[model samples]
Every structure is written in structure tokens, then in C-alpha cells.
Target chain A: MEIKAIGCEPLSLKRVGIQDGHTLKVYQDTGGYVQLKKAFGMSPDEIIQHVKDSALRGRGGAGFPTGMKWSFVPKDSPKPKYIVCNADESEPGSFKDRYLLEYDPHALIEGMIIAGWALKASTGYIYFRGEYNYLIHIMDRALAEARDAGLLGKNIFGSGFDMDIHTHTGAGAYICGEETALLSSLEGFRGHPRMKPPFPAVEGLYACPTVVNNVETLTSIPQILEMGGIAWRDLGTEKSGGTKLWSISGHVKKPGVYELPMGYADMEKFIMEDCGGMLRDNKLKAVIPGGSSVYIMNAGQILGKNVTLDYEGIVEAGSMLGTGGMMVMDETVDVVETTKNLSEFYKHESCGWCTPCREGTDWLVKIFNRISVGEGRPEDAQLLLDICDNIEGKSFCPLGDAAAWPVQSAIKQFPDDFKKWLTKKANGNGIEANI
Target chain B: MAAATPTSYTDKVIVSDEVAEFSPEIIAEMNEHLAKYPPERKRSALIPILMLIIQRERGWVDNAGVNFLAKFLDLEVTDIWETATFYSMFNLRPVGRHHIQICKTLSCKIMGEPEITEHICSKLGIHPGETTEDGKFTVSLVECLGSCGTAPMMQIGYDFHEDLTIETVDQILDSLR
Candidate 1:
């Protein structure tokens, strides 16, 4: 069978010399930091407007317009603002940022420079997850090269735009991906997410105006500025412009990152055609359209609906195009076990800063574990829903919602499978009994 | 197979005396991390410090390490433990040298994680919480290693070994040995 290529070309901007992490020459050979050079000549507002025109949205699950997010930072705020690259790719099924960081460390450095130029921030930081220790080393080497080449630090590229980039490693807390929580961590706090309204735009990172963007979101900027925003905007849908790196994994023949234009690709076609369908003779059972945090959709539901691999289509399907992580499951899989697994993840990762998230995730995991083990009660489904509802809006950050959404959505969509657990329990099956 | 005697602190050449007095490179590594944040907010470095301590020592933070870390950061022991237990990275108990953290998250489980996990337990002659008598391997069920696409995976040390099978796991364990 022939496969049609969709989306933007896999521009090897980030992966030019991925194997050799020592030098920036390969990065430079690939026109690395040229956008920063171009951006240096432009004013902060001009750079901001260029991103606005490009229509790039946050690639870190929220899908918020990146330009609009930058604009939110108070222009009149005092000195010492910040532009944070959310390299905390802790979302399950998402590994694009790690690739970018490992392969194209300089791309992120250049993107950070562009973001710093736009926000008029002198300092920028890449808040990486602790598990990505190897990538951290890669970034460190890249940062050193940039500094040596005079691409970073004061008076960068002789354009009089002084910007510096720093790397901060997160201590294994998924909650730190939240902007405010990231700030708290950056400030050397316990990483408990702060409340909104004073959003990161108004008061972020040392209580100054800040603009935090996902790694991919910022990496797209140098390209956008170099290519011109109008040209870049023409790639994807009207709202979500530019190219996105979709991290497709699970049961697929090709489980790797694919760069594609948003909205130009369909999930089914991408999974079946682009990914060579499910592995071997296995049939598709379900898909967590985004990362593990998003709602799970049955294979039939996905087949029935024509959904594109973009922000709009996913939102229409009651799920977000979160980090473009398409985690596919095959027919042999057990839905109850899947839910229990996700529940335990949320429970284990919960920061315990918020009451609902701390206690609720643990309870949800326990219940799901019981259900998956054939000790489920009839009311457990509703009880799971009730707990999820408690965690959704009551927690301090989206960690609560991230944990609750999958469990609640899975039970709602796969009620029959959940009911099977209860029936098995009635038959006196052991808790560890298989499905 | 003969049992290997547990190496005493003196028998093992301590890399640094400061590490012996303070518990290993975890504190110094944590201080380097703390330098990134402003001094006023040093508490933020607590989690990574505890994690490093556990990783260097293998498995979870014991009471002494937790107490030492708490005093080192001017935090209470309970506060340190709370942070330690909150994330799956910090182990609360002793584990083998090569802590095999299996990714049992949704995507992994769907890809037949039960058999993979069971195979590991049977191979090691220990359950999830148990360590082998030889002290070469310890199997622990981790919530997620964030590599769900290559489900049925396990992490040894900092490296994530994905796309698991009984054969792949055996090779991985052998390679570690």
C-alpha cells in the first residue's frame, strides 16, 4: 500500500547532529540561530506581532495561542521579566520535547532568545523534568556553545539585544509543568501550583511579568520569524498555525515522532496509513487522543467520527489535542486495567499540595485497582465519577483535572467493561484475577 | 548460588568524606540545583535533593537520610518524607542496585504489562516490593516512566528500556549484571 505524506517536511533543524552532542557546528550548519539574528534586528513588539501573525498555539496541551500568551505579559511591568520554556514534558505519551532537547538543543536556545526578545526579558529558563538527565547534559553543552559563539548573553549577535538562557531541572513533579507551579519551582519553592487571575502573565517568576511557552511552541518561533508569519500561518488550520511534532506510539508499526501540519492530518489515516496500522494482526481497540490525561475514545467512536489531528477536532470530540500524543491500544487490551494503570500514575505523581488532588487521586487509584482485579462494586463507577468531579475544579492546578479526566472518561465510554468487573466480583473471583 | 555479603561503609571506598559525613554526592548535587533558584526559596530544591539521595543510595529514603536531608534544608522530617513519597521517583525503602521500575501506566498495561511484570518477578524470584538475595536486582512497580508508546517497558537507573518482552527483559537484566 502507498502512503501519502501530510504536514510539513521533517525539517532536520533540531536533529542535525543529534548523535554528536559535543559541537554546535552542525546546528550552525543547519542555519541554527539565524532566526535569532533576524529577530535581534526587530523590536520586541515586532517580534511579538510576528508570532501573533503566525497563529502559533501552545504545544503543551493547553493549545493557548502562543502570541496571545506573550501579549498577556504586562508591558508596563517593572524590570526583571522572564520567558520560560516549559521543557517539562511530563505528560504521559509525550516525548517530543525530549527529542527536541536532545537533538536540537540550540533550536530551543534560539527560540528562547526570540521569546526573550519579544517579552523584552533579559533572562530565560528551560524548566526540564528530572528524568531527562541525558537531555539536560545535551542542553548544557548547547548552552555553552551558544555562549562561546556570542549567540547568547549580553549584546547577542551585535544587535544590542542582550538575553541569557538558563536551564532548571524539575524534580519529578508533573504539576510543575503548570506555569505557576513551574515558577514556584524556579523560585526554589515546593512546586505547589499557585492560583490564576494573577496568572503567570501578570505576576510570574519572581513576581514579575512572564511568558511561559512549551518547548515546541518556542522552537517554531525561529522558523516563523525566518519564514515570515503569513507564510508560516498558511501551514495548519486558522487557529493553530505552523507545524507540530506528533508523538505517535503504542501498537503502531511506526511508533515515533512525525512532523505534520495541524488539521491537515486525520487520526485514523495517520494511525492506519502513516503508522502502518496496529502491530501485526492486532485490531485497534481504543485511543487516548491526546496524552493519558485526556478522555479515552472507543475504536468504534473514533471510526464513526471523522476527526482531524488538530486542536479544533479534538475539542469537538470532548478532548484536547494535548501535546499531540496519540497513544493507541489494541483489541487484546483490557479497559479496566488501562484505567487502573492511569489512576495509579495520577495517584503517584500527585504533589499533595491540593487536598482534592492528593487524596482523590489515591482513592481513585485504589478503587480502579480493585475494579481491575475483579473486586469491583456496582456503585464503584459512579463513585469514581464522584471522586473525579471533586478533583476536577477543586485542586490548585490542572494536575487534579489531568488525573481525574481519564478515569472518569474511561468509565463513561467503557461502562460495559467496568460492569464486567463487578459481575466477576459477584462470582467471587480473586482480586488479582485476569480479565 | 552463594549469597553476597552486604558491603560495609568502610569496606567500600567512600568517594568523598563529605559524602560520608553528609550522605554522598546527593547533597552537593542538590546544592548545585538549589543555586539555580534564589536563596530565599531554597525549599524548592527539596524534592530533587531527596530524589538524588534515594537514587545514589538505591531505593527509598530511610529515616536517617530523610532526617539528615530535613535538617540540611531546615525542613521537618515529615515534610521531607511527604515530598519523597509524593513522587514515584523517591523510594521509601531499600532496593537492589539496579532498581527495575516497570512502567505499569495505561498504555503499558494495554500492551500486556501483566505478563511482562510477572515475568520479571518470576525471573528475579521476588515480588514487586522484594529484592533478590544476591542484591543485584530489585523489582518495583512504578506508576509511569512517561514512555507509554513503548508500553510494557521498564526503567533501570536513568535509562528507559522500552518495547519489552520476556527475552528483552532477560537481556536487559543480564546486561546490567
Candidate 2:
């Protein structure tokens, strides 16, 4: 569902416009794997340098520079290096990676191969979430086609480099989206996130030097090479290079994915115009600019401040541009209840690795459940924030931070709603937590 | 799932000695997945083989299947349970033929998921996480399946049913039977 494609040029999604776009024949005819050849011609150091020059930040959420991440992998290590693609798009509001995987699987394959070549890794794995099992066959077909065309399996483009990519599926743990936890899951363990000093870049899969790139980050590689690094960097804001895809959802008239250059437009204009405005003629009450995990922004904070959907732009507006999965809420949505709903998500997906996250999310959900049912105390908002404070950076991974941010922001922004729900009872028969 | 009964689970470390037998073709498939990782790291293929067992069992991961996998991968039974309970997709208990996993996360919730969940439950005459008497349907309120752009979605079997309304839910259930 490409609702409105407004961008200077397409990077990852360009192949989506062509008929049989996902097929190897059409992808090659339209210059799909050409970047791999270009990347092959360049030295490994040169490719990494090019990516570093492009200022290509991680599209997953953390906005870390991709090339810097690659450079972290120790060169000439005794152990073989590995490239892992974090295709597990499990963030609550994020769905753009699924669209890319379903539409242009080859871009991801090319990116993985190129990353492998740059890092001198011969093996790569694309960790697909178990929910997207339907796409496994499609990806397999794409891989088979690549192999038949000599784009995969041993010497590629006569570069004498051998690389093979495999697809792995996770059952349903959201924490597996975290790189270290992903490596843990890939190694056949519970998806518990490990401590960061031994980051995945240093001692990843099988304890070897590994680089885990997100789906969007890896997919952007082909185009980053296609257009020289600096030229690509100039396409967007001075910092966040190239185009970004925004997954616009919730109470919007045109709720779909839109590819727009980074910092292309402000929140009010993007929501009111590009998204065809709010649904049911309701006034836009709030906007979660980057997935459900980011701070919930009120209309005043976003529209009033003229916020943009870039990494730095969102940070300036007091939130991270996490995954670019924007969830727009209109006047009818109850912020307290919505915040409670998100708490339930955090509670369900917590991997029970650390005490703060495992118990903090559960406590938040319990408190929100009481708040929704009109049992909230006068100090409930403060108490919720207190729990959030414990969970902000105290857990093993960012899931704790993600679980805490929205509740903390909602209380700070909509102080009245938390108290308003304190006096209100939920309407209609609600299902018990049977699952 | 066994996760609910942690006390009894911790008390018992018993894995059934009798393991389920798989056909030669299924074993060959397991071998193919095994070959994906290094020989010493056969545990890396644990997830794929578990998926294969879940498909063969036709509902959930049973002790028999777990025992078989532990033996097949040379892993302890504890290894299988750790993974099984950690992830939401693997069913520790038996499920009906068509399992409906409705997303109850924020994106779907704001988009009328409570109404949709209620409608599905009322029509099926069962609460979430429960299978009907006829053994035809089991409904689970799962977390986000990454379809938030088209919110208020669910997964029945392997297919996603998104942007759901009352009529669509009714038609989907009727067609399932």
C-alpha cells in the first residue's frame, strides 16, 4: 500500500515500481545487482570508507552510523567474521521492513552480500520473525534465482569472494530484534539480551566478529553505492542522508507507507496534507512519530513546534525517530487507555532477562489496568513515572527504555488525561487477560 | 503454556524417555537445516527443526516432540523449554486446527481492536487462549505482527487478516469452518 510516494528519488523501494520487480530477471534488467559489482570493484576498505562518507545511519532506530558499526568488526581476526541482517521488524508500529522484504527481497540480498564482501565474511543470515513465515518461500525463491544468476554462492562477479546467505526465523520474541539477543537466538538459546561491552560487533554469532544490519540499513547499501556516498548524503538533511520511508498509520485518511526524503516536511504539513489529514474529520490530538516505543507527542508538541521526521529533527522535538513508524491519533483516542494498551505489549514481549524490564513492564500494565478501570490514585501519574524512571536505562536492553518512554511522555504531556481516566470507568465488556 | 506453572516446572526436570518417531523425509529435512550451521553448532538449527516439529504435530510443541528434538540436536530438554516459553509463537499446549492470533498492541488497540477481539470471542463462544469444544478454532491475542500501517490485524494459520471489521471477522470464521 504505497499511498503517496513523495521523495526526490527512491533508494530501497525503486524496484517496487517495476512489473515482476521482485524477480531476479526484472531486478537485473533494471540494474538491481549492479551495485554489488561496483562494490566488488572497490577495495573492502574503500567500500567501508564510502559507506562512512555517505553518513548512512542505522534505519532500525538507534541512528548509529552504519559504516562505523562495520569498522568495529576486528579485521584479520583468527575467527571468521559474519554478517547478520535483522529482518525481525518487531517494534509495535514498525512495518516498513516487511514491505521491503516482501517487495524487493533482492535488495536485501545484495546489501547482505556487499556487507559480507566489505567485512570479508563468507556467511550471512537474514533473521525473519516467525510471523512473516509466508515470506520465507518468496525469499528462498529470490535466493535460488540469485544463485542461478551467479549473484550468490562462491565467486560473484568474478571477484573471487565467496558468500552465502541463509534465512532464519524467530518464534515471537520482540527482544530478538536487539542485535545481541538476535545473536543469542540465532545460536539456539532463549532470546535474552547480553551485556553490551561485548557488543555484537566484537563477539557476535559463535563469538566471532559480526555485523548485524537492519533491513532498511542493508537495503540502502545498493543505492548508496549506486549514487556515490557524498551525493547520496546530500539528498537529505545535512546529517541523515538519503530517503526514509514513513509508515503512517492510526486515525489518518491515507494510512500507508510513504517514501519521503529525510526532513522533507514538518509534522503538521505531512499529517494534514501528505497523509490526506485525519480520518472522520476529527482533530489530530497526538502523533507518535517513530513507532509506539518513542515518546507520545501531543498535537502542540508536534504541530505547534513544527517537528520533522528525521533522526535529529525528532530528537529536537524530544523523541527519537525510531523506525519511522508514525502512529497518528485523533481526538477520539483516549491517551490513558492507549498508553495502557502499549504497556500490555511491553509486558507480553519482555524476555525476562533483567529484573527492571521483566517486573517493570508487568507493574506498568497492572497500574494502567487499574487506571483504565477507575481505580487510579491521585499520585498514579507520579508512581507510573517512578516505575518508568527505574526502567528507562536500568534494564538489559532498550526494550525497557522503549516500554517506559511512552508512559513517561504521556503523563508529562497529557497530565490531565491520567487523572481524567482516574474518575472514568471503561465502557463495554472487556476481555480478561486470558492469553 | 508451561510458563504459567513455574513452581511445578522447576520441581520436575523429567523429560519423557519415549520420543516421537519422524519419517525419513522429515529427518532428511532436519538434516538439511542442520547442515546450515557448523557441525559443533548443531544447536543453531534448533529453531528451524522446532518449526518442522510444530508443523508435523499440527498444533503445538508437545513433550514427545521436545524430547525428539533434544535427542535430535543433542541438546538438553531444558534448552528446548527455554526457547519454547520465551517466544509467543510456539504453543506449549494443544491448539485447534485454525489458531487465530489477534494483535492487542497499541497500534491495533487504538484502531478498534477491543471491538474486534470482542466480536471474534462472542461469535466463537470462547475467550482468548481457549479452544472451542469442536476443536475447530483457538484464539490468541498476540502482540504486534508488524502490520500496524494497516492496523487492527490478526493471523489465522499463516495468513494475515488486517483492517478487520465485524462482517469480515464473521465471514472469516464462517469460511474457516
Candidate 3:
């Protein structure tokens, strides 16, 4: 249960140091809901302005400015507004949200209160992922304690504002992590993505002006309020403010979630020093700088590059800092096989709402499977690139594009593996024969 | 579990013969879950009710259970099926007493999941999607369970067993046996 925050002041993981960190009493002892009190005293407009000043971006993959997102909700909407907390952490290698939800559930609760106040949302829903079934109990217990202690429910902090937060469990769809799809699932339907333009802020959840924030994004609210916006802005990079939590996994010696300030020095140094280097003392082959969906950074591109741990930094490195889920691959790994495995995941999770996504994802998997099993044709790599190009922007949602990124990136970076697979042959079994 | 005679909406739309009815105590429990949301949004409680039904009907969500959920939440049977099938956790058919869900996704696979899957399947005398002849064990290759930091993991029921070695897998299986 140790949460490490290196080279930066801890905010979200601060309360986690206390005994029974998840409990209301323990949380309150460490100045827990005091931010909500501060928030309650301020006008909603002031709170929104403060958040805007802070430059807090959504930590849930998109990196959209949080305050800007809130401002999009029409202040005078007659329809009942809602605050939907996206806790569906289904990104292949991401697990930091679950850590926050399980260990410090009350942080999310308090943060949601302020979020509700800022957006004038009367009701809020924490759309928790189904795989993290155990977190539901932890959150439910925390919510009960908050209700009993007058932290939640009608007229909180005697502010005359009535906000109620409910936890909704997602069955097991990765696509539901998409805001509109999450809303659809919360409304008891198949979790499918909706076309944008009438964004969630304009018309979300029950067709009201809704504000959807991620678990980590909302949880960061209280701290942002506690330390004023200007101070918070100075913590991270100029554009990306505040500390970022990195979920480092795969072939790392010490794999865990590490919170470091955005624009932290070198990605390689961070992995080597903070994460205890590659596992089994193996050579580093590649790093999926973010989650599985992000493009891969081959070792040649990373070993000497001045890669930082922020959104712009990762994008400059030819990958988005998606969920900050860094999956390290050692030399023994096969990039082609890894891409195939990820393609399979996207294929399975794609809500068959569009033909390019529904068909393209499985086709990507099929092609990747051929490469992995030594049945790849000489033209297969070109075929994968063409399919990816079609699926990138042609599909309904970003899931189609996400399905393309890994395959396209892997082939673009590491063609030798695919070429080797093409030249080799497999017997009846999947193993490479006459390698 | 009384036998439910299907009111044939269509020949294709046949619900289970065994209609499930919750006891008064279980009904009270469901009401508490319903009280969490607004009165009109009772449909939001669909997942929890399906969870309860799955638990009540051993390990899977049967057609009868879905029909009961439709009446309980005032949703259509089609609505229930869409939600149930969309989620990977819900078992549509009867699962073994112990369902071993090995994560076959990228993070786990890169950390030697194929060997682990092969080992477990070989040991249990069942493939990834099959149940054992004794109905004691079922091995399913699920997606990432969000425990990638501790890779090569499996969830038997709700509990996750991570950082798995072949010997550790054997110990887990033997202990269950």
C-alpha cells in the first residue's frame, strides 16, 4: 500500500500515508473534506475560474483542460446537470485509477462534491469499471461514511447546495471509458460511443448538460483548490500543470505507480533509477511510452532521446502520454507478437458501431496473428499500414484509431521483426519452424 | 425457482423456463440498491441486480434471471441481454465452480502469459474456453484485469493472483482442489 511521489510534493497520494487511509475518520484527520468547505464558501464561478487558472488537464488519456471542459456546460441549462466520474480504467496497462479508488475513495468523493458545485450538478455518478469489482465495496463504504457524517447528501457544509453521488458499475467494456459510451452504459444499455459535436458537456447523461471527469482528474480537484491555482500551475510544465502518476509495468525490475511532476527529466533515467531498470538485467527493446494504444518507441529512438514524462513530451516522441501507462519491453520480447496481442484486445473491446472499427480491428488482429505465427506474406506489412490508414479517422470513435496506432507504430519502428516473420515458416503449430 | 411459461412475444424471444424470484430478504437488499439512484433512473441498478441474479443462480446469468431482471428493473429482455453480453465478467451459461480467468492481453502476454495459459490448460485437461469434465474448474482467457504492474495474473472468481509462476499456478490449483 506504499505510494511513492518522487521529486514533487504529493497531493493525491498524501492521505494514503495515514492508517486506514480509505476510512472517513482517517481521511478527515488529515484535513480531508476541508477543500469542499473552502469550495462551498466560494462562488461556483470563482471555483471554475480558479480551476481554469490552474490549467489542470484531464488525466484520463485525453489531456483536455479540465476547467475548459467544465466551462462548456451551459450555466443556464434548465435540464438537470450531472457530474460523471469515469473510473473505467480499462486501458490495457493502466491501473492507477483503481489504486486511488481502492486506497483513497474519499478523495474522489470530496473532489466530486466540488466538481458538482462548480458545474451546478445536482447528481453525480462514479462509472466504475466491472473488472475492479472489489473497489465498488470500498467506494460504497466510503460514500456511506460521507453521508452519515454530513459530507454528502442535501445541504452539504450548510451551503444550501444539494449534491448526491452514486456509484455505477460498468460490466466489462473498454469502449465505455469513452465518455458518451460510459453515459450509454450508465443508462443501462450497450456501452457504445456516440458521435461528438453535441459533446458530453453540451448534452450528456440523460441528454442534460453534463460534465464528465476522470477519477484522477476529479481527485486532483481538492488539492488544486487547497494549493491555489497559480502555485499548482508552477508545479508541472507550462502547458501541463501538476504532478502526473506513471503506471510503469512490463519488464521492469520494480514495477509500480510513481507520481512525478510533469516534464520530469529523462524517460530512460526515470525507468532505470525509479523503476530499478529492466527485469532480469535484460536489454531494453522498446517502450510503449503510455498505455497499449499509444505508439511504440523503439530502443534506438529512446536510448539517447531527451524524452520527458508529459503530454507534449510523449507526443514529440511520436506517442501520446495515454493514461501514463508505460509498458517496458526487454530484448527477448517480440514486437510483432506484442502488437498482435494488443490488436486482439482492441478487436475484442470494439463496440461494433462502425464497419472500419468493427471489421478493421479484427483484420488487424488477423494480420498480426499471421505475422506472429510465421505465416506473414511479404506484402502483409504494407497491408497492415493500409488498413490502419483507413481505420485511423474513417471510423466512428477513437477506438478505431487506437486499434491502428500500435500496429502502425510497431511496423514503422521495428520492420525487421515483421520481415523475419515473413521469411520464416510455421509448421502446423503456431511456433516458428526453421527459424 | 418456479418454471416460467413463456408468453411468446416471438418464437425467437424465448426466455428461460425456470423464472427466478428473489426472496423477501433479497428483495429488500435490491430495494436498498435502488434507493441509491433517483426513482426514474431505477434502470441504473441493472448491473447490481444482474450481479445478484448471477450469484443466486449459481454462477451464470440464465434467461430466467434476465427475465426476472426485466420485470424487476422495468427494462426489456433485449436490454438485459445487451448489457450482460457486453460485459466480460458475466457468464451467460453455467460456469464451473471455480472459473480461472487468465489475462491474455498485451501487458500480461509480454510477461510470459502464453506459457502460463498452456500450463494451466494442460494441467486442468481443459482448453481456454472449456470447463473441466468434473465441472470443478473452467479456464477462460480474459482481457487485462488492470493488474498489469503485477503481470502474468489470473482471477479465480473475484480474487486476483498475480506475478504467477508455473509452480505458483500449480499451488493455486492444488489448493483449490
Error of 3 at B122 (Å): 2.0
lDDT of each: 0.76, 0.85, 0.85
True contacts kept of 3: 0.81
- Backbone clash total, candidate 3: 0
| Runs of candidate 1 exceeding 4 Å displacement | A1-5, A12-22, A424-435, B1-35, B38-85
Write one digit per residue (lDDT tens) for candidate 2, span B76-154: 9888888777777777667899999999887788888999999999999999989899989999998889999777999
Pitting candidate 1 against candidate 3, the one with the higher TM-score is 3
By DockQ, the best candidate is 2
- TM-score for each candidate, following the candidate numbering: 0.87, 0.95, 0.95
Clashing pairs in 3: none
Task: Give every prediction's interface RMSD.
Answer: 3.4, 1.0, 1.6
**TM-score for chain B considered on its own, for each of the candidates:** 0.77, 0.88, 0.87
| Per-residue lDDT of model 1, residues B1-177, tens digit only | 954533422222222122223535655766776765557766766766666554465455555566666677777665665555545556555668887888776667767788999988887789997789998888887665567656778878778888888888889888888
- Residue-level lDDT of model 2, residues A257-334, one tens digit each, is 788888876888888988888899899898888988899988888776778768888889888888999999999888
